[model samples]
Target: MRNHKYLFLFTIFFFLLGFMNIHFSLFGIVCMTLPIILVLKDRKKTWCQNYCPRASLYTTCGKSKKWSSHKTPRFFIKGNMKWIMLAYFGISLTIILMSTLGVARGVKLPMEYLRFLIVIPLPFDMPQLFDIMNIAPWLTHLSYRFYSMMMTTTFLGLILAMVYKPRTWCTICPIATVSDVILKK
Candidate 1:
């Protein structure tokens, strides 16, 4: 734990880079997919336990009792929270794919702003850090969607960390839930 807890900083770095260059948000794809792939290969939650940057962040914070330490309510833990997250994730993925496909088909879908929870668009738009004139519009759109999803989860995790034990979000994280569901069979 001591050796690897700092890996959490990658989560912070990811957001920083993503905000600077939305293309960096593509890295979220690795994060979102790697856990499930690792779990499938190892038949375990190896990503959550030893390598998840978000989990490392939680662990780092847990070293101090600075957080509320309240146990997650059974309402969230007994089953529903994970499912809700999974549904949210699934719906977001659907929107991302469908919209990107629409753009690719030459539909004039305006680039959407930073959406929280896949619905709440923030007032600010992502700035173009570098010239993207050569980049395909659909690719840009895809990056935006990926960034939003990653940000949404990070915000949720931070809120959960503050309100309960730092690792509370992990208990119901979509990746963790998906792993659980797959492993059950």
Candidate 2:
């Protein structure tokens, strides 16, 4: 029942805020990110062990203890950690790049779709694109609020990730949450 509840939450529209940069306002992003930290801090594997698709992938790829046929690796905690970390980082960077490029190019998804991207604390200076691309949106300038919000949330998220685990962001990340639902079941 809990799994179904999580799966359902992942599939819903509002929770999609985790995927985008401008969805639920800045405060909303923190609300979503906090739960992920709590979940990963659970040393008992309550979250990833039962819920993460990437976790399943790691196990199947012989990168996780759950799939090592009961024989654990010597560096169980540290072994191959970088690879997993890199893979997760790469995916995140790709998604952000693609979404930013898409939005900057005037690629219009539904407002709801944009909500997901908006909720994430996007790290890049999106407004700078106007000057860099030589585009003309001479009306509204990037507000101090935008950068402040972005930096604050992104910095907190990173600090949490570094202090806890490398891919701490992915734990409750809407993108990862969605992908896990799509691929795991």
Which candidate comes out best when scored by lDDT? 1
User: Each candidate's TM vs. the true structure?
Assistant: 0.91, 0.25
RMSD values, in order shown: 2.0, 14.5
Candidate 2: list runs displaced more than 4 Å: 1-22, 25-76, 108-185
Q: What are the lDDT figures for the candidates, one per model?
A: 0.82, 0.37
Give lDDT: candidate 2, residue 163.
45
Q: Tens-digit lDDT track for model 1 on 22-88?
A: 8778888899889899989999888887788988776666656554577788867896878988898
As a whole number from 0 to 100, the lDDT of residue 131 in candidate 2 is: 28
Q: Give the residue spans of candidate 1 off by over 4 A.
A: 1-3, 62-67
TM-score of 2: 0.25
Q: After superposition, how far is residue 131 of candidate 1 from its true place, in Å?
A: 2.8
